[model samples]
Target: MYRKYFKRLIDIILSGMGLIVLSWLFLILIIAIKVTSPGPILFKQKRIGKDRQNFQIYKFRSMRIDTPDVPTHLLENPDQWITSIGKILRKSSLDELPQLINIFKGDMSIIGPRPALWSQNNLADERDKYGANTILPGLTGLAQISGRDELSILTKSKLDGKYVENITFLGDFKLFFGTFVSVLSADGVAEGANKKNSNEKK
Candidate 1:
């Protein structure tokens, strides 16, 4: 009942309130991005959402205008494309604040599997086997707090499947709060090209 109905209700209410309350911070970040980078303030990318639907996910632009559209892990040297303010935004997870708009618009939930990139065929295929793609994507979820950028696509998809298997108000509550702790400590964040390099080494 909660998953089919009340969860979305909570997403709407909380995301709406968040947009209003965080407007000031949004403006500040907008100015910061403008001052530091010469590109669009918001970076929109096609991501796989509910039932593998395509949707544009929004984030604060953290890379230079010329940065490639490929995933950061695919880049040979991602740090070269990241701006100074972008680094802080990525680490603090403030870059994802715009996703509240996604949540409000029903493209996402406050907690669910993080959306797969349109180009991430391997991850998408893995998730299909677990039925994780049947639900809306999220601003953060089990895979996010568990390892963020550190986990392999298979492991991440499995965790996402686990989350789908046990969607509940209490579970969402814990994941939501747990996200804060993960952000503060910058847990499991593998910066850009390093992630790729590490995997190659492994």
Candidate 2:
């Protein structure tokens, strides 16, 4: 009942209120990105969403205009592509604020599996095994709180599956609160490709 109905309701209410409450911050970020970089304020990229659907996920632009469209972890030198302001945005996760619009539009939830890049077939296939691909992706999720950029793809998918198996209001509440703590502490974040490569090699 919570997953099917009320979860989405809460997403709508919370996201809507968030957008309104955070509009000032958005305006500030918009100006910052413009002053520090030469690109659109928002970056749109294809991501695998609910039931494996392809959707354009929105983010505050954190990379240079010429940065490759591939994931930051795939970049040879992600720091070179990241602007000064972008570095702070990425580290603090302010770059993800635009996803509140995604939540409001029903493309995502406040808590669930983080969406995979559209090209991440291996991760998607792994998620299929746990039936985690059928639900709405989230701004943050169990995998994120567990280890963020530190977890291997297989492990992340497994945790995502676990989240799917136990969707409840209480669980969502904990994950949501955990997200704040995680952000404040900057926990488990990997700034470049090294962590992903190291985890894959392990």
Give per-residue CA lDDT, model 1, range 1-202, as digits (tens): 9999999999999999999999999999999999997889998888899999999998998888887767787787788988999999988989999999999999999999988888777888999999999999999999888987788888988999999999999999999999999999999887556585122100
TM-score of 2: 0.95
Candidate 1 stretches greater than 4 Å from native = 197-202
> What are the TM-scores, per candidate, against the unseen true structure?
0.95, 0.95
Q: Pick the lDDT winner.
A: 1
Tens digits of per-residue lDDT, candidate 2, 49-159, equal: 999999988999888888766667766678888888988988899999999999999999999989888878898999999999999999999988888888888999899
RMSD of 1: 3.1
Give the Cα lDDT of each candidate. 0.88, 0.87
- For model 2, state the Cα shift of residue 16 in Å: 0.4
RMSD of each: 3.1, 2.9
In Å, residue 149's CA in model 1 sits off its true spot by 1.2
